[model samples]
Target: MTRSTRGGAPVAPKRVTPRAQWTRGSPGGTAGTPHPTASRRRWRRTVIARRAADHVCETFGADGIQGVCGHPEIEVALAEFARYTGDRKYLEQARLFIERRGHRTLADIEFGRQYFQDETPLRETDVMSGHAVRALYLAAGGVDVAVETGDDELLSALRTQMANTIGRRTYLTGGMGAHHEGESFGLDYELPPDRAYSETCAGVGSVMVNFRLLLATGESRYADAIERTLYNVVAGSPGEEGTSFFYTNTLHQRVPGSTPSPDEQSPRAASSLRAPWFDVSCCPTNVARTFASLGAYVATSSADGLQLHQFVSGEVKAELAAGHVSVAIETRYPDEGTVRVTVAETVADEWELAIRVPGWARSGGLLVVGDSEPETVAPGMARVRRRFAVGDVVELRLDPAPRFTYPDPRVDAVQGSVAVEAGPLVLCVESVDLPDGAGVNELRVDPAVAPRVADGRTVVTGRMARFEPTDWPYDPEAEDVDETAAFEFALTPYHRRANRGPATMRVWMPCA
Candidate 1:
């Protein structure tokens, strides 16, 4: 299972060790020479990681290292090295790993036969299940193998599984992993806001899978998923401008707990209050890496031109089939719906610029090319092909109206309640913003009223019906309890909750 390098040391390929070197220098490095010190440092880490991987492979054989589906982890590493170095041997090893999966090699594990996704083979599996992170990482490896081997059937199967994951298993924040038991995916429409185990690591893994999918299909939907998760779950992971961290993200927290000390571990599965660090602290490191490489996700190049997926204010320069195009994007996106893209430099006379229209942009969207007439753009993406000049601007306006969303009826947890969302942010009602003695659970939203920005925070002014509870369950036959005067309350984004202090928060509210 282990590969021998120079001196018979079992390690990952030497080209894989160049990862840190590539990261330190330009990713567009020449294949001939690599920087000396960075290469050494990266090789050290690669050996350490490969030794661990080798130990697992030797222990588990075809069952894989971490689990039955874990062979893809090593396969991805080898495939990446192969792509960078053009080594066919590494590709062969990667192909071997792919072929060995889906035989239930680790079925005897206490969790069950399907626990490690060994129940079904990659090409035959239609629905994404098992640990959310593992499933995503495996799919990414599958994408690499499919692209390298020119396996059209495997590529199509991976796309179908990606669609199934995005359409049915994803959260409003683009977070995955609904069950805390195994940090795994649950049944379709089984999403529960309160009991969500949307691990931060899983969210990062989702972005990785989506990025690979984007490269494979040249589609904008994958970028959409990346953008959503980046803004909501991943952005929410770092607390107070990247000081603390949240390992798990939940849309709602109905009860408040005492804030734990910086040295203390959180008693709850997911903390309402962000901690400075945790014992198992992969999230903080993952968030750091994602932020460092964010520019890579904002724009992608094609034979025609460049496509912009995220609207963050940044500079995008990409070489296209026509020539190189550089554009400056200015926008207060997520907070505001306006994006202005100005062409700073251009080598191509005529090319295409594609901007993604978020699925939640209910009022559709508007795109204006230069001084031309404004044209409405539907969801998916808006493509503008034109001859460009320096200083020419493209304006896109997306609807920012606050909208209330309801879950599928099958998700019994929030069946009779509604959640509010403005742009990509999911809104929650926190006790700190409410009157004393009034908890978030006692509040209700008036769907007729629109939410507006108040004091730099999104606020929905709604009435809460007051009912006096006397027993465990009110008898239908008995007289109804007297109602007190209705009071008004406000709602804020779920990510902003507990920032001021530990407080109860609720995303789903009853209709008054």
Candidate 2:
């Protein structure tokens, strides 16, 4: 039987086939033993799942595919696949999954409906709760379906949830899922540093949702969130060479040991160093795909004109509503905030060139066009619409000054501490950056000292004071000798931790 896709898109009928096979790893001995590792098992399960999905696609045709609607990630993927392939079957399946959330289709045995996001329908849910990755994935799917089907209510609901999440649950480093207990989001303003369950997968999902929202609404705010997450959380999750990964990204590590524990999956358990692979291994895979597909997030074409969301050294060609536009973006962005967009080809006579001015650049950076007066851009996006010719140059000078950031007063952790941020990167002090005896907790940052760029990283000069624990728990009479010392410490990007071997690290530093 043949099935037609939604939106009147043409598709050839696919037939079901059996192609499952057993495979072995690299040979070791004469006959290698079966690898019983969790990584191997996980890979095997993924292969099986893909085959099963193919079988489902062929057996049910397009529109005939239907289930009880569990596993929000799979549902989201189905929606995205439908959109990409112009298949209505998967889109309908995605909608069914999203719409039936509150009906309790899945068995919520121990954790209940909240864990599976079944207690409340997305449209009615006020705040995004439960599993952080799952919630973000579900919302992203909603955005995909809503944009395709012209459903404004669903889009609005998701926007509300996003706004609430950004205002309350999100960390300064753009990490998500505040509570370590369920690996889920906690109440409003419940961000905790040591107890954070900000999984790397969640950071990837945050960018996914923000990108979709930006596509659906053409909002600059979503792009801002995308930039922050990409730099601080997503970039920081992986090691420098991309071999090791941190499953749970923490804001602060108070202890000295730098070893990966067997129970590293627990958010409370701090793995000071990144591991080659984790028992779960979701973050590594997610990071791989995210980095590979980063070009799609850099720019997009709207009815008004072309838009550049991210700054990267690449060429973007798009057929916009105005006409065909081609431009080359050259910059060492995130390292420095100067992007030069040279118009390689512009077919249209006039079209708006919208560029995002990051939220952190509050000083209203300078935007200069060819032979035009330098203009200041507000926090959102700066646009210039005029007759354009070939070789037109647009220069955007963004403020890359390092600034101190403080968390909300309601957040109990890091109350008196401050985090340093330069461009999109969140700076952290590693033990390797400090003196031999000066611990991370003992080093204090003098806010008055200006951070300087050195050795491709930011360095903060500050005063350090070593506090010795006395035998008496409470002693009003304590001799205060000279324990203060001056030190210049280098701050590494949060994402690049564990790259220089395992060491203690702290994002928030106490003021001296």
Give the top-scoring candidate (TM-score). 1
Tell me the whole-model lDDT of each prediction, alpha carbons only.
0.72, 0.74
lDDT of 2 by residue, 272-387 (tens): 67766565777878988999888878887765467788899988877765667788899988778899999988865677677778888877678888777877777666777777
| Model number with the top lDDT | 2
Error of 1 at 344 (Å): 1.5
The CA root-mean-square deviation of candidate 1, after full C-alpha superposition on the true structure, stands at 8.8
95 Cα displacement, candidate 2 (Å): 0.9
TM-score of 1: 0.85
For model 1, residues 1-512, the per-residue Cα lDDT tens digits are: 11111112111111101133332222332233334655666555654544554454455444445344442466677677766555455566666667667887664565554556677888998878887777777888888888889898998999899898878888877889888877789988778888888888888888888887787776667877887787778877877755677888877777786665887766436566788767777787888888888877777776656677778898888766677678999999888899999999886467766777787886678888778787887776677767878998988899776678877677777777888888887777888888765677667666676666666766665554555554656566334434345555666766666687788787788765
Error of 2 at 284 (Å): 1.8
